[model samples]
Target: MPRVLHTAQALVDVILEIDELPPRGGNANARSERWYAGGAVTTLIAAARTGAEAVHGGAHGTGPHGDLIREALARDGVILSDEIRPDVDTGYCTVLLEPSAERTFLTVYGAERQITAESLATLAPQPGDLVCISGYSLFEPTRDPLLEFLETLPEGVDVVLDPGDPFADFPRELQRRVLARTTVWTSNADEARALTDLDDLEDTPEAIRRRLAPGAAVVVRDGDRGCLVFHHGRGTQIPAFPQKAVDTNGAGDTHTGVMLAERALGADWESAATRANAAAGIAVTRHGTESAPTRAEVDEFLA
Candidate 1:
């Protein structure tokens, strides 16, 4: 199996359910609450289920919440590195879920945010491997080290970058450096607009393609409507699989994970996107980050 290296952190998410978002100085009662293993693990699970070897290339956390992540990854059969941090406990995110299932997040950074060069070196990406990086790691504390890591990546590995909501307006120069090394760039519609300074960016995938690093593909995901992929000057709109969505948290992660795994195995763009679409469709119907479908589940959904 081909390898998709995820140099992302494992976060323990505390979920709180509320009726609606309240105004300033207002309070909302919780409908429910629980903890789950979230963050980049969703994408890795989706990719691993699709038959690629999933690797945790960064320092897996330690201590209380970190233990939960470790156990979940073990149960899911994800491969971990020796980069486990003993110096600090894991970080966590407080996710607020509304009645409509839309979410608002407040995070507390812990050990997961720290990425050392030595930890990254253990993965040793090579030709035919796929790398998973997010703009979250590029923002502040980890920016300099992460940049150093990206610059030193083995030439032939296909690098895939996803700029989560937090990275909507990432610095142009850093974005350019990442684009230069990225094989495929994935982002949400709002993120696309914010990053490109084009309010109507979705109208043309060409603009994204033109601004991308050489030989890279631009993938802009439009929730429910589907995702658009631009490569070699051609645009392909891969429609989302229709489903009654209950929660939207891990859906995009599932899609990116499945697509990256499929691409790593040499699958064509359309086919990869379609399968990823199905995986996300199944994910939304269920609850939580670990809800991403298995390979058999995705096949059955397609069938």
Candidate 2:
């Protein structure tokens, strides 16, 4: 089995660089246009770029957009799972970038939203594998499949959870189950606060730790403020690498991918989070969601 067995969506992204976001019922002009692959694949590719053996499997549309994402994944040489849905069209997102490089995404989840338990059962994760679970999946209507899949992970397979959306909206029981299975949990600063009702950033990790079993790590990432990693009952803050972020589109996904990759490779928490920070730092400096740094690029950046 690959070190990282990731089950998530990979969709094409349509990028429009605008001076500012348009007001509701208003229009805006674009400075430029670009198309690239994006979404959960961001995490898988970022991890694969680190030279870790990686595999991605999930339902995706078989449309032209899916073709774009498929070609992109092929170029990276990532192993793919045969769970594609040919009847539906792949999802795509329109990413609007402001002058400050912040992004606003208008997404329409497509074929990928049709994930089911039968498809997920195809994943044969072995001992020591890391199965990436995204909150995006939880938002889908097929909760039964997701619950079943999570409950069925092999004993040696550990879960790394990234509650991808609305931390507050996540069902309490789902959170409870995932936290129980999670070996490492990642969330943004705001999500962490919402989930734990903790204000002190330093205190959030501890609060999260209380929910997780011992030996699990909680990573609270505050964009530009850096990140905190809590493992074995101790927390360490790792400062973000300074960069002129051109687009903040997939920085968090890049961080997640790199971190998972490093952990699967036996790196300690500090080392993995540090490398993930560097990888995300490089990602935001470039354009497009597939902008994760390669192993050479990350090493060069660190050097």
For every model shown, the clashing-pair count is: 0, 0
lDDT of 1 by residue, 1-303 (tens): 568888877798888989998998998999898888888888888888888888887666669888888887777788886567887888989999987879999988888877876677677888878888988888667777777888898777778888777665676787788778888788888878876677775554677667666777888888788888888888889998888888888889989989888887789888898898888889999888888888888889889
Write down the lDDT of every candidate, Cα atoms only.
0.82, 0.84
Error of 2 at 61 (Å): 1.7
Pick by lDDT: which candidate is best?
2
Q: Which residue window of length 10 is worst by lDDT in model 2?
A: 135-144
- C-alpha root-mean-square deviation, each candidate: 1.5, 1.4
What's the TM-score of each model vs. the native?
0.95, 0.96
Clashing pairs in 2: none
Taking all chains together, the TM-score of candidate 2 against the true structure is 0.96
In candidate 2, what are the lDDT values of residues 131-236, reduced to their tens digit?
8877777765656677788887877687888876564577788788878888878989988888888789899988988887557889999988789999887899
